[model samples]
Target: MKKSVFILLLFVAGSLMAQETRLLRQPTLSGNKVAFTYGADVWVTNLENNITTRLTSTGAVESNPVFSPDGKTIAFTSNRSGTNAVYTVPVEGGTPTRLTWYPAGATVCGWTPDGEQVLFASPRETAPSGFKRLWTVSKNGGPEILLTKQWGNNGSFSPDGKKIAIDRVSRWDVEWRAYRGGQNTPLVILNLADMSEELIPNEKTTDINPVWLGEKVYFLTDRDWTMNIWSYNTATKELKQETKYKGADVKWLAGNKNQLVFEREGFLLTLDIASGKTTQLSISITGDFPWAEVQWTDVSQRASSVSLSATGKRAIMEARGEIFTVPVENGNTRNLTNTSGVADRSPIWSPKGDKVAWFSDAGGKSYSLMIGAQDGLTPPKSISIGE
Candidate 1:
């Protein structure tokens, strides 16, 4: 079985909408051997030795890290050049090199199995459509190959590298329908050789993130009004709804090979693709809100958005708002941070799945970054940087 990955193309349009379940291909499959950081920074771990190595030491933000086939090098996005561009470096240590200098930005990097080229999605500076563009660059940084005319992001190559799946925003000029329920986006796939694109947009539905296993293209869809697992077969062009969890955020874990792992109501669940069945992955008392963006229509009809953790294992998200964990696998979740309802969000996991980092207002400032271990059995430790 081959593994493929796709990411959500995040952008703001006519109305600040909230609805996304996306993930750039980070090298987490190497067990603790890989993990990407915010601002395009990449780190690799040796699971056998529990050795964590910092691959890049740049002040520029780096993110969305992917490992080479041999696990020797990593490709990621960096702003070292004053713009978000794709850069590659050795897993051990070295100076990073730029792959895309298009001036607009090279956001996401999907590495080929052979580690020769990277497929990515970026906003085009001169694109006529005013949306993002999807392109592929050589590992050594060469000419980019354009794939679509519409705004494309979250592009991933299959384990075999024969197929590429991505999330495409058909247009950037968004016409707000109403920030009540949710907006619509399309989950699309492309055949790398012929450059053919396929749209599997469900009725009045928006889906971001596309991953592949064997023949099924796994993606997150809000078709049932609640985001859950959905699969499409490129050969049959048919769609199947895998899970139905209402009022929850559902997304795919990077390395979950034959099973579909997603979060539902703060509990992580796994679905079997072949049989179209789902099972519980984990559960906790951590009461948290789903991430991406959502059309929050409160009684007053006010509109605001939220950020979700990529791991989907948190209950209370967003510091300054509320902070909670997804109930540890065993035992109750300890209050790591007793912040008084601060707005904290975007909790990401380290390769070892030990430490978690997120942006929050628990510090009383605008938003201070916080890092704590998953063993939230103790008071949540704040790993905010010292000014």
Candidate 2:
């Protein structure tokens, strides 16, 4: 009996350890290593040895790590100096050297093909805040050069350095799957010598991350439902799907030479350019996830979309993507949507003061109208809203 109980406990512990962990974003690849952002901090991992290293350990968020062409340094964005600014540090890990000092922030997009300068996107001259333009600054820190006069962001220079494949508009919600909103637009490859343009034939789909690799432009598109790797041959004007991912979308992709690496569903995958073969790298990142620590958090400032109950004695609120109900004078505070990977939004209290309604993706591909009791006792009713 004692042995059976011990084995049962061991099985439970193994199950808990096997739970999936996510939110790994903005991955960039070099010749032998891959760098990505996890828990708002930059991390690097070797593709061959599976050795992982932490690049930054600051209170402020640091993200969007891009490797220099030589693979000696990494450029990333950090709010360590107050506002978001471009910064670079040694790939082995050390103090970062600030590159841009303008009042408006810049994000590292990619390095110049010649490796002379670091390319970035900023909105310093743009009147509006959302619109961004591509710019480049010397790695040694100097004046910024305007790469594009029009509104554009997330661009990569061609191999010849005379042209670029860029995305004109940025999406508001990148994780909202199959989004065909007004912000969606096709990518454009602009020739700098003649100021000429060529469209990539996007009818009404979201296309982004226009990477110019040799004579082909590799990008991410949700035209076939789930986001997958796609390539457009400049010479033949042919578009083809590179990967057929059915479950999770490919999060971030970066490539150099004949190899490409990307992150998908918290796992790292590498694609061989010549052979068209993809291999999932077995990388084990072991470090202190400081942000994942359990502690009391003040959700007051994070609250949004609050609606009062019928009698005004209670209120339903959405805070940090979780739906909750709090009392004014009596009753206990309850978290309605406790599932971590799911998204519950626009929570509103019912007029009758008995139920709450909200729109939730629930980590699925579609959104649903979720209705449940205000007190958290009953299972929520989910009605499909749309795809």
Candidate 3:
């Protein structure tokens, strides 16, 4: 009976680990499928069948996946070749084809309406200021063509492919909540034919991730001190807020004429353009993470605090949130506090060399003073440090 219960517990634990996952980001939608970046790889899920497939598994930071017009191909940015560049892979999973070779790196934004070229942002031509400009390269492979001289970090072409709704500046600190400073800029509707520009209405608020769908230009903004989805109707000359999320800001907005996909609070969600309804996707990812495997790490060079014994025979040090001691000339290095889950810091040897003192959060609360023998053979006495 005991052996059967142990085996049943293992099965229960494995089942819980295979449930829905969070932290999904950079979602792009087309038809009944959506693609996003998770665990540094691209994954696609079909809304109808509820099936998810991993597209790229190179273990190289791949992100910003944009689906093509027909939903057959996906363009994304990857640093697999030592630089962030554009790459394309099929929706069903296959070999990724390199698209750009710029040394300055390129980030995939979106594709043109015709689906013949892939659009990206790069700082290749801008040397002194290093501001990015819009560029596009043929999906079949060729030299990238400069789309415009104006700065553009993220954008999407209109349905006609004649105009683009673009964000002119990319913020240095994107996650600084409720920030209103000089870095904030409005989105621009640039006419590719005459190079004329029309700025979206703004009052020094952050507006980014422009996606053009039909007569409206949809984007994410922090105008209300919380990032939410907003739209600018060109025909009616009106601006309206679509989503009223209060906690976390919406990120990585991308879409087509049918619907829009974005990330909010680590979940992938979609908004119907016609109906204005939103739905969160439930996706579960199961795979082997080689980097997360348990292994020994050397933290000697990461020592943050150190103190020498009074006799100069040993030294106590704090490194990687743990306490350690090393002999000056004779003995091997010893880890005095091996509590990996707790943070032990500011270690110092006692003046008489019989004890070690440090601050630790071993009680799972606030830090407190910990005093123990130098050999770590006895239990450390923890003294409370009140709030």
Candidate 4:
């Protein structure tokens, strides 16, 4: 086991230095509890004492896990039924309930802020126009509601749930093909009450992932045709570009309207709307790709990188010969361990942002869970999987 762990950690360190980091999606943090994908499984960790629990099984490729508003349940899509369909499970692990019984496969984007429904983009009917509707489903796991009659995806709900902001695929000059990235999609905001749709700045630019931050709705746009990140204000009706750097895949972590935790250029960064300043999140060379993304095979050589817990305070990560940390805001980072043979992988922050749980091969053949402190840096206690 010790020998295997050494090899695993060594591999992750090598990968970081080996490739030009392929950016994936960021985990959505709800308070101190966040969901993470590991080898087709979604696991939740409590940061208080490093208690890790598996929230998903039948894992046949589960990703994009989002927590309900009450944090008691998780909403995500799984290919367990041979196609992508929405599934819900208890935050801790239990039987999953299928939300979308559509005969067609589907993928979800965002959830309503109230946790009452989920918003997604998928083919609504038989293939004729390839019409993908902006759809939402009740958390009670019933039939879904087709909110918009257009073919689009990447949905976001305003904080109050009165409005839905999404990317619109307006012009389709070609035949409909599902699951493939379509064309002519731009940033679109839909008023649910009135069904009035409004288009934002650029039509050709890919304006996706619209997040409602209080008075303004912020989204990632390549308005300059650079695939860079941008933001929009709903209250002032002012449009703004937040970054000069080419950051395409970005996520809003947790903060007020002005402050945001996001990822850009393969680095997790924080931006302040009031100050117009950005700060690099204190993380190691963690890759953005999560376990649920690709097949369990292609990324196997890929090791776990860095992850933020619900609190977003301290970061727990595995790399090379060290599991390290610095103060998230003020303190400097300190290396917790430097064992060469123990290849630690996948650090998840607990809901309280107090403890961290990770998988390491220090024992042998199979990877197991290791729980430790958010800052104290003691050796991790192995979590029993009952295998």
Q: Pick the candidate with the highest lDDT.
A: 3
Give one digit per residue, the lDDT tens place, for model 1 in 294-381. 3332111211233323454433233223334443232343334544336556665666566666677665656667777766555555
The clash count of every prediction, one per candidate, is 26, 0, 0, 11
lDDT of each: 0.58, 0.83, 0.87, 0.62
lDDT comparing candidate 1 with the true structure:
0.58
CA-only RMSD, every prediction = 18.3, 9.6, 8.4, 17.2
lDDT of 4 by residue, 1-387 (tens): 111121222223323433232242354545555455545667665534535466665539887777776778878889898888998888868898888877787776767777788776777683765666778888886777887775566677788888877766533432221213446465777888888877776665555666677777777655564444566777767887777754243433333335665655544455667888877533222334443233212222443466655765544555553565544454555555554457666676778877777776775556677778877557768876643
Comparing 1 with 4 on lDDT, the higher-scoring candidate is 4
TM-score preference between candidates 1 and 3, better one: 3
What would the TM-score be for candidate 1 when compared with the true structure? 0.55
Better of 3 and 4 by lDDT: 3
Q: Give candidate 1 misplaced runs (Cα > 4 Å).
A: 1-27, 31-34, 38-40, 45-52, 158-162, 170-183, 192-196, 241-248, 251-253, 256-387
Whole-model lDDT for model 2 versus the true structure? 0.83
Worst 10 residues of 2 by lDDT: 5-14
Better of 1 and 2 by TM-score: 2
lDDT of 2 by residue, 213-294 (tens): 8899999998899889999999999999999989788888788889888888877778999999998766555666555554
lDDT-based ranking: 3, 2, 4, 1
- Compose the digit string of candidate 3's lDDT tens values, residues 62-88: 999999999999999999999999999
Candidate 4 local Cα displacement, residue 354, angstroms: 58
Which sections of candidate 3 miss by over 4 Å? 1-17, 300-387
- Lowest lDDT block of 10, candidate 1: 281-290
C-alpha RMSD between model 2 and the true structure: 9.6
